[model samples]
Target: MNAKTPTSPVPPYPHPAGGWGSVKALGISLMRDGAPLATASALRKQNKPGGFACVGCAWAKPAKPHLAEFCENGAKATAWELTDKRATPEFFARHSLAELRGWSELELEGAGRLTEPLRYDADSDRYLPVSWDEAIAGIGRALAAQRAADPRATVFYASGRASLEASYMYQLLARLYGNNNLPDSSNMCHESTSVALPETIGVPVGTVRLDDFEQTDAIFFFGQNVGVSSPRMLHQLQEARQRGVPIVTFNPLKEVGLVHFANPQSPAQMLTPGETTISTQYLQVRNGGDLAALTGLCKWLIEADDIAQARGGARVLDAAFIAEHTQGFGAFAQAMRAADWSAIERGSGLPRDALERAAKTYAHATAVLGIYGMGLTQHREGVANVQMLSNLLLLRGNIGRPGAGICPVRGHSNVQGQRSVGITEKPELAPLDRLAELYAFEPPRERGRDTVATCEGVIDGSVRAFVGLGGNFLRAAPDSQRLAAAWAGLDLTVHVATRLNFTHVVPGRESYLLPCLGRIEIDQQAGGAQTVAVEDSTGCFHASDGVAEPAVPTLRSEAAIVAAIAQACLPPNPRVPWNDWVADYAKVRDAIEATWPDVFQGFNQRFRDPGGLPKPNAARERRWETDSGKAQFIVPPPTEHESDPSVLRLMTLRSDDQFNTSIYSLDDRFRNVWGTRRVLFMHPHDMRARGLAEGDMAHVTTVAHDGHRRELAGLRVVPYDLPRGSVGGYFPECNPLLPLQHHAHGSHVPAAKNIPVRVKSAVA
Candidate 1:
């Protein structure tokens, strides 16, 4: 889907292939489980004292300290944590690891909660139940053996669900073992954003808070659909629209929900036929064409400012702020002036008039907010695209003020926080220095491998053991065909999760599945109930305490698991106080407070509110943290801007019913996709050009860069309203078509949004 193309007017439905799969599962799940017991537990936990943060999305504004604070996904996360089901020792006895591997991702997870530690017995192809002591001993032995062989062979992966305490301990253990090979999920998704943002602004997080939506005069949404990705945000957008704030959208596909969202919170609106008009103007940009659209907008705004100044009116560009806080304005402006309008129009798939109109709308606004998602970041020029966004916001002095700033819609709840707490495989000197002083041990100074590098390491035998906190690393990564093969080469593989996922099925020579506590479950230790801490997208850290008890008595919290593993693998690193921090998360928070006093003040006390304090952004206040104390702009070298007629640009999309890599069901009710994930949306003109028609099965193959042949089959082409030479399809299914090496120009983020491919009709 080209970012410049208008979205299809028809609402998307549940994907037929996957939709029915989810419906059947949901129906049975609801019937068997009844109402979630976690609801009662969560209600009790809210405000009686301090409540735990919602573990769903990183946008943790402190829970309103109210019962309604939790969203549906958050509730599901809670319910899954608090369910009555259990995967006990007996269950493992009945099923082998081989047998579990045969199960589908959804079925395996749906089986039940993990009740005991299980180790793979390759002789029988089964995972036999083992005592905790034995499991720890095996882990210790594995680490000892591997470190003796090669210290850097071990990679420590952290899931975002791991609380601050667990993540700290996890990193400490890795460093103690003499390696910083931490390849967490953050590496796969937002590492590029994290790396690029701080260089432009001082902070990697969004400068805008939820409250900013309340005060904004206009919002420019790029490549983000709130209703599907972050439904909780719909309430905010609906409120903003009701207040007469204009909502402008730039996306290739027209998301129906963005146009006419029925606020589930509004009873009357929910019952009425009318939907809220979200976008006053929608610009359809080409897939991977965001930089051009952004450049065009910036250029148009500059020209408008010149006109305004000549007419003796308010200036659109913040000349003084740019002069004081940013560098390279002259070069940026010069490049913009020199940029060809014809090139912009052709590359963006949007007309010059449309670009000018959108720019004029932005220029007229008193306050503006620019929000984008993976569509902008998962491209060849992802980092530059982000830099361009920062440039646009700076042009009007739109950041660091009330109702104006930049917002990168994060996927996971604590992804940003995980990065903050040293989850990165590539850590800078400052954090390492702080860790060295705080932990008393010299942390690994060398940069470690990221997700891409980690995969390469695994394939080449440089990495022996892979320990994941949560998530299905194999399924979520690009080039599943190759990743699965690489996993077989590992010496040891451990997955600490609540239930079955794809990672558990792909066995290493020695594998272990350790079940841990979920966010909804109560985690009790010697000191009454335990409270875990997590940071949200806005950079506010809050404590999250689970209300309901663990699904089974045998389940342990991730923090407890990390501590036990640390104790097993490495000698005591007293500087971290891993054991004490694991015992009570508050102690960890105290340590964090001690380490970084400038940011998190009285960290434990501030979480008592509904909305946490805003994280600081240097760019927002015209305070540049760069070398020159000025934000530098890059005039990216011009590249060929032609889209071949034979190949269409494919943008991977998630259905409304999906969350991250987890597909709740195939039904995208809003998008009208029913019971199918293997479908593509195309423009009628493109279909006619290729002699293709709707419902035709086609094999989509990518143009070769490194002689990698990637293709998907049996895809029905729905000739809907889409931009010419652009198409849309769900990911994981199309993942095979994306080469592992085909990533962002510099960041190695898989260019999931923009891949050039040719479609051939499948022979009957």
Candidate 2:
């Protein structure tokens, strides 16, 4: 291990996912946040039938509940949100905007929850307290002014933390204001899944449910670190391993979570010293190499099927399922057969025999689940990468069956739900027609800017006003320096959030920070205390009502904030009842039910059920919603392996202590790095090839096709188990190395992974 100047005294963690370390971490978080009693009560309600969902990951709750339903990250998220420390007017008075700007993201948020609405006072270079009504009115006026000038000048952004009702109301507000410039975190994370899944399987969501893990004969994980990102999923994986199921993983780095895990909830795991091994076989696929690897698996499956047919043996391919429910099989098969083996080996950084072994394991299994995360989607050919995985699943008739489907595990709890409730730039006609009928208002038919497009538009002076429902858009996005400048150039910016982030520190010309109730905080309104709902990765719609009181009396619920903004902006409409909707959240759910009747039918009643209703999925029912009325077998074009002996493929990742853009701590326990996020992880061979070694400071420069020379200096190179010719660094910090225009072809998602970079030794 490299010996660099330690950021903290914390040592590298040696054990797997859960165990005593998780307990210790949880205890530390609780103590630091000074909310032990509140956290305990709130955690008990997490993922419960009548309680709030965990704010951490979108992994579904089990049908059978556990006492501790929350994972380690969930505990951190809850503690972080329900912290006793407050960022009050006094705190702001103590620090200047320029001083706060110098602080790290973790430091900015760790200052604690924003107690009240604040407006940036440019004259004083400080944020001062403002009345909720005053903030709302000011934002509404600015939005109206922007609309009068040009509707496209205003952009409405949403974060995944917002509830389904809140998202519905927010989108309604944007559409009513006559702008579809709605871009959310999904554009940066899982947009590829949204684009490719619909084209391939006639649906955009995962076909499998939580229970499918019990029946799955095999599970294949692509670029997902289940242990750190979605720890609860590790329980299911542990059980699968215990049941002798083959779990194959493909990633650029050998993530600790995918290698082994110990369930903290299990008494045996707590008492036992040994941990359960996770992946039966781990393949270190190169960054942006999933497409080639998946194609290789498909090719091997085809070859095996042909050999079986010649020998008059049992068939490997599900021919019956193919003939009945799919299209373009012939073209897909031809493409797979023609895939170059050498190209697959080079692209994937794995030998042909290894891929063959993986294919054999997959072919032998009666049921298989394909799981993936941002790593597959944050690439130049992300859509193609996802389509290739779908192609592999379709070969084995994985769709419309228990334990057999494609599961794109999402990072945010309700990112999928946000899209489901109409928080989208691309509005389908069916939903628009229904919404118009329900609200008696015409929705804008034109397509709006996505995340990448919004950034470009803002930079170019097209987007002038920005309203964020949640999230640190400036930090989470690509080209941080450019984005900061663009955001500052905006005429007005409004953020409804619980805590202070980097985005709040860097204000637009005029900005307002509207403090909102956290997920674990009670939301009281005119009608009474209200409950909000969230959807998990599996499309399960469940209610999430806060158990604790709001961090501050002045804080408002997300639904209330959106409704207030909408009420203030638009003229009074007889058909739309924003006031009534804000008073009771049921009315908002009713509005959603009215719009998407097929999916949200009886939503209010069904949402209260112990296990929330599953959203309607055409792919799960084998009912294709495509033009041909069948799931399409997309034949992704073969991609040549792009390799430069002088440059390494750089992939950006989240530290174990971070969730999305929220940094809990600087320590990344799983990867053994302590107290620092500025270090790079690379294979020893690669470091040696570049005349570098462990703890050597390096300057990393991107080889972008757009000719933008993006670089990050003074990155400490730490030799690790990553594939040769590949390097890894934490995101947000590395986001600068990614060009604004370098993104997936159709999805427009920034290729945070697969950045081509050259590293040179830097004098430190």
**Which regions of candidate 2 deviate over 4 angstroms?**
1-13
Per-residue lDDT of 1-764 in model 2, one digit per residue for the tens? 33343232123357887888889988988998777899988888888876789988999977677888888998989999989999999899888889999999989999899998999999888999989888988988888888888887889999898999999989989999988989999999899999998889888888988888989999999988887789888888999999999999999887878888878877888899868999999999988788889989999999889889999999999999999999999999988888899988988888999999999999999899999999899998999989889989999899888888999999999999999999899966238887888878888999988999899988898988899999999988988877887678888989998889999888889999999898888889899989998999998899877799988788888888898898888877888888899899998898888888899988998887766788998898889888899989998976757755897889998887888889989988788888899998887777766677677888998887775568889998787776888889998889988888889999999999988888878862
Worst lDDT run of 10 residues, candidate 1, spans 14-23
TM-score of each: 0.93, 0.97
Model 1 per-residue lDDT tens digits across residues 1-764? 22223233344442221123333433443434334445545745632236666656665453353345544455454445455666677876788776777766556666667888889888887778888788878988887788888879888887677777778677777877888788777666666677677777766767887778878998999888665666567667777989998888889987765675654444575455545777888887878788888889988987777788999998889888777777788888888888889998888889999988888788878789988888788877887888788888888878777999888888777777777666777757237777778778877777787788887788778888998888888877777777787888899998898877778878899989898887767888766688777777667666677766667788788888888888777776666666677677888778776766666677777754556644556666767777777777667557336556797889898876556666656666656777888898888777666666666777788886786677888998777666788888886668777777878766788888888888877763
Report lDDT per candidate.
0.74, 0.87
Question: TM-score winner among the candidates?
Answer: 2
Q: Which candidate should be chosen as best, given lDDT against the real structure?
A: 2
lDDT score for residue 420 of model 1: 64
RMSD of each: 4.0, 2.5
- The per-candidate count of clashes, in order, stands at 49, 1
Clashes of 1: 49
